[model samples]
Target: MRLYKYYRPDFYFEKSLRYDEIFFASNEQLNDPHDLVIKPYFGNNKEAWKSILKSNAPFDTWCLSKIVDIDNDNLTRELNDEFEGVVVDDSSSISSVLDNQSASLAQIFEKYLTPQCNAMFKKPEAASAACVQFLKEKLARGWDKRYYSCSFSKNPLEPQMWAHYGGGFRGCVLIYRGLSDGSINLRNNIYISDSQNFKFADVNYQDKDKLVDILDLNSRVNIIEQNLLNKSSFWSHEKEMRLLLSESFGSIRVSIASGMPKSTKTQIFHHAPDAIEGVIFGSNCSESYKEKITSMLAEKYSFLLPAGVPAFLTFDSRLTSQGKVEINYGAKCIIREVRSSQVIKEILENERLNTMLKELGIPQFN
Candidate 1:
C-alpha cells in the first residue's frame, strides 16, 4: 500500500517537501479533459427502469418528490391521461401512483433533463421515455457535483513516469508508507477523515470509453467506479490510483463571479512527516534540488528516528550497461538501506552524501 507522487524540481516540489503537503486538482484542472466525464447509455432495461420508479430511493426524494410538490391533482390527472388507454397488468397500484403524483411535470422536466434526453420525452407513445429521462438525470447528477483528487502510482520506478511527471529525470518522487489500516494520510489543514469522507480506489483501465449503462444494476450501483475509477487503456501503463476528496468535505473552496461557472482548481493537502518513507531523485536531478530534499528530510529524521523507523535514505537511478534502469546502493546512491540509529548518526557525521548534509546541519541525528 505504498504510494508515490512525482514532481519536477520547482517551487511546488520545494513547497511540498518544506510543508509536507500535496495538491489535489479538480477535474477541470486535470491533464486529461475527458477525465471524470461519463457518457450515459439509456438502453432497454425495462425492469431496471421499473425498479427505479417503484423504489423509495434517492430518486423518490429528489425527482419524484419534487414532481409531487407541483400540484398533486394536476399530476394525477396528467399521469392518468397519459396512461389511460395503455394496459397495465396490475391496475390496483395505478390509483396509488396517481395520488402520489404532484406538480407540473413540465417544470421538473425542464430543470433536470439535458437537451437530448428532453427530446426523448417530447415524442408521442414515449411513456417509457419518461422513466428513462428521470433515471438518466439521476445517474448524471454526479457530473454537477465537484470532486477533488490527487493521483499516485503503484510503480515508483516506471521510466514513463520519470519522463512524463519527473521532467525527464530532472524531478523527484516522494514515497509514503500507508497508515496501519493501509490508507493514505492526506489532510487539508486540520481536517482529516478517519476513512469516512475520503476514499481511495485503484484506477481500472478499459479499451473503450468509460460508459455507464443507466439501465444496468451494476452500473447504477457503482456510480463512483463508473465515473472516477475508470480510465482509458492508454493510461494503463501508469498503474494509477486516486485519493478523492468530496466538495462538501475538503477544506478548499472556490468563489466565482455570479454568472461564471464554479471551479475547485488546485487544493493543497498536508501529510504527516512520519508517513513519508523517503525520496528518489531522478538521474538528471540537479544538486540544488537534492539539497532542498536533504534539508526537508533532515528535519523529518528526528521525528522518524524515535519510532525506530528505517533511516530516511536517498536513492538515485542509473542506466545499466545493459540499457535498463536499476537502483543500487553503490558508494554513490543507496536503495532502501536500513542502518541502526548509531550507524545513521555516524553516516551523517561523515557527510557521505557530500557537503549538502553538513551544510544542512543534518549531523544532529539525535
Candidate 2:
C-alpha cells in the first residue's frame, strides 16, 4: 500500500547537520559523499520478498557512496559553466513573464476567487441560528409585540402553525417540515392561530413568557421558509390583490357578457354629445328599434349648439355575426358589446385588472 516517493538529498540536510564533522569534515563546507539509489520493485527479484537483513547491507553501503564526480575539478567546471548560462537565461525569462502573469493572476483572484472564498468562510448558518435565538429571548421578555406568535406540531400534515386573533388579526400559520434525508412533509398543523387560547401555567408570569418565546422561535422557522421561496423580494401589491379577489369571487367572463349597459349607451351621448358620426345600436332589429335609437340620438344632439364638433362614431350589425359586436368611434369613442357568456368570463378571469384595482386602493365590496 505504500506509494512511490521522490526524496531529494536536500531533504536530509537538516538531519545530517548533527553529524557534520564526521560526514562533511567541516561545518562551512558541504563536501559530503553523495549516494543516489534507485530501488526497482518490478522485476523477478523485486517480486520476491527480500529479508531486512539482506537489504540492510546494500542500504548501508549505498548511504556512504563516494562523491567521485564532485571531486573531479574539470567535470565540475564544465557543469558549473553550463548551469550558470541556464540559470541566467531562466532568470531573465521568468522576470519578464512575472509582471504579466502576476497582473493576470491578481485580476482573476479579485474578480472570481476572492468573493467565493469570502462567502465560503462566512458563518451564515451560525448567524441565522443566533438571530433566531435572540428573537426568542426578546419575545420571552415581552420586548417585541409586533410579531405574530405561533406553535409547531409534529404531524406530517401539520408541522407548523401560526395563530392570530382579531384587532385585525386572526389566521393560522403553517410550514412544511423538511426532513434530514431531503424529503419534505407538509405538516400544516397550526403553528399559532390565536394568542388567547395559549396558556401560561407558571405563577410568576414566566410561564406565559415562555409561550411567547416559543412563538418567536416558530416565527423564525417560518421566516427561513419564506426566505427560501422569495429571496427577500418585495411583495407585489397588485398580484396579492388579484389572488385575493379571484380566489373569493371568481373570474369575470368577457366573450359572452352583454355589451355596455343600457345606461352606458345613453351616457356615451351625454359624455360626447357631438359624437354622432354614423353611430348605430342593436343588431337585426326591426325598423322600429332603429327609429327609436335615431330619435333618441337626435333629441340628445339638439342641445349641441355648435356643429361639426369632430363627431366620429360607426357601428355595424354585420359585426355581430361572430357572436360579438364591434363599435368604432373614429379617434374619440369606441364601444363594444358581446352576446356570449365568454365576454363576462374574460372580465372575471382578468386577475391582473382586479389586482390593479386593489393596488389603486379600491375597497373590495365582497
Candidate number with greatest lDDT: 1
Residue by residue across 301-341, what tens digits does model 2's lDDT show? 33442442222221222223333332221121222222111
| True-vs-predicted CA distance for residue 163, candidate 1, Å | 1.2
* Candidate 1 TM-score to native: 0.61
Q: Write down the RMSD of candidate 2 (Cα, Å).
A: 39.1
Task: For each candidate in turn, give its C-alpha RMSD to the true structure in angstroms.
Answer: 12.0, 39.1
Give the CA lDDT, 0 to 100, for residue 91 in model 1. 13
Question: What does the lDDT read for residue 239 in candidate 2?
Answer: 18
Q: In candidate 2, residue 18 scores what lDDT?
A: 15
Residues 7-38, candidate 1, lDDT per residue (tens digit)? 88888788887677878886677877767655
